[model samples]
Target: MTFNLETERLILRDLRMSDLEGMFELDSDPEVHKYLGNKPVKTKEESQKIIEAVIDQYEKYGIGRWALINKKTGEFMGWSGLKLNTKMNGITNFYDVGYRLIKRFWGQGYATESGKKAVDYGFKVLKLPELYGITEMEHQASHHALLKIGLKYIEDFYFEEEKIKLRWYKIENK
Candidate 1:
């Protein structure tokens, strides 16, 4: 399969080693990570490791989170894609849609747009029966984004490692 998927305003591709700085800016924003770990990444080095791990996941899994770049300016806006994370509960434990955008990119409709494309990729193209998504129970924005992308609220659950009340949503191919 190709390493990238393109949308009208975004290019969703696998992260490269050179994307560390952009990744740092995206992952290290406190507000962006608020519903995530409730902490910024702390350093550029941590972003580098994350990029490397994402690359590794692509190599092994064939599908992984993708870096979202603004096609017009070639700027890294954020990332949105699919992953098979077993960590989230009350779901099938496979094929989840996820996104993390820089603070500056918030409220631009990018997350919902990319999420719609990712869900299409997962269900229409990837031929999965359904795709799951998780968000912190308090993350109204993420919950809104997921709903905008056609996912229905499934249930509330907990992930031990994240220690956050989570809600799961699913988009069915049917």
Candidate 2:
């Protein structure tokens, strides 16, 4: 499950065990999870399991979120890519484009940079008919990033279990 996609200043690659520390750092920050149910992972083991699940996703689905590394420093910044979502937000099966970075890496356009590449890979490489994105209603940054990645606003849906309103966006391959 090894693959790599390079942006101008970052490298998007499969999540591996070597990324446990960086993944922990990125996921443990409360600020980074503010819009994500405010649940920052509490242990490195949790991060390890998360990475392992992503690796399994690669084996099962052939694609998943990839680690985002700083090309110049080779530091793991975070993860950005596509994930196969099943029965999410009332959708049976779909590919969702997403990204996340360490708080320090925020505001640096890394998400958008890698996100655009993910969208390109989805359309051109995977030959997906369309791509989808979902963000908390108030996650302005995520909303903007998805739009910038070329997805158009589709609609907003209420996630009953989470009791949250989520905005959905989509882009079709033409």
Which candidate number maximizes TM-score?
2
Q: lDDT by residue for model 2 over 59-111, one digit each (tens)?
A: 99999999999999999999999999887777888999999999999888888
**Ten consecutive residues with minimal summed lDDT in candidate 2?**
84-93
Report the CA-based lDDT of candidate 2 relative to the real structure: 0.92
User: In candidate 1, how many Å is residue 146 off?
Assistant: 0.3
Please give, for residues 1-174, the per-residue lDDT of candidate 1 as tens digits.
356778888998887877888899988888888889677888999898888788878787778888899989999888899997765474445899999998888888898999999988887777999888889999998999999999999898877877888898988898
lDDT of 1 at 6: 82
Error of 1 at 120 (Å): 1.2
Superposed model 2: Cα runs more than 4 Å off = none
lDDT of model 2 at residue 125?
A: 88
